[model samples]
Target: MKICAIRAFTPLTAALGLTLLLLSFGPASSSTGWLLAQDEAPMRGDKKVLTIDDYAKWRSVGQTSISPDGRWVTYAYSRREVDDSLFIKEIDGGDPAVVVRGSNPEFSKDSRWVAYYINPPEQEDGGGRGMREAGTMPTDLHA
Candidate 1:
């Protein structure tokens, strides 16, 4: 009688353990699905796709520094495949001027002057070789 009782209990215990294991590792519940559905909904209706021309005309602005007296702002701007230009403008309002052709513009402590680095133009070997073969190298450092 005791053996019969033990045998019947064993199969029940095995089924309960398997069910618990599956529940722990199975896919997430319906609440997770509802949250994901909310996130997938669009926030706006009037968005337009961007085109290549829009990208071509875009100017990327880089590091900016303000003058010590708060009178001038200096920044670097560049377009794709173009040399970077350092621009300086008056805070009150005026056309920005190209101070130099370089990157990483900095303002002096007294805001009297701006400084930056300019890479020297590449040199050709005069052998009518392509860029990969000519190996033009930067020759000078400018500020």
Candidate 2:
């Protein structure tokens, strides 16, 4: 009896196969009916189509840090068309302290304080044509 060896497709192969499959449809202008149909079809289960207006609500997080005592955490959240904010929260339970237009948080050695950069307000002149600079440090570190 002879046995055949089976081979599994890697991600690259799968992507290439999909690309070839799509390319087989010929020019997009002439063969995009099926793709357009999928977009135009009514979604089931109360699903709604996404629009450009929803992009402003999207947010991203970066530069996370935890205090040495493991009781606190700091992170930065940024949104499109809006200012970024830094948040310092107690791990166990407490309301978080929010710093508007802040990023890159760091905990002090004793875990009693935090340091972060404060971004300058956005400039409206020519929609910010010039290059923006880094955030400035706070002169007063007191709470």
lDDT of 1 by residue, 22-121 (tens): 3223132211211111122234566434455444534545556555555666566655545566666665555566644555555666666656666443
Highest lDDT against the true fold, candidate: 2
lDDT of 2 by residue, 1-143 (tens): 12222256765445433433343343222223222112333357776464665545444455565566656666665667778877676655555677887776766666777777677777877455344344433312334
Candidate 2 TM-score over all chains jointly: 0.56
TM-score, each model?
Answer: 0.47, 0.56
Model 1 spans with C-alpha error above 4 angstroms: 1-45, 52-54, 121-143
C-alpha RMSD by candidate, in order: 27.0, 17.2
- Which residue pairs overlap in candidate 1's backbone? none
Clashes of each: 0, 0
Q: Which residue pairs overlap in candidate 2's backbone?
A: none
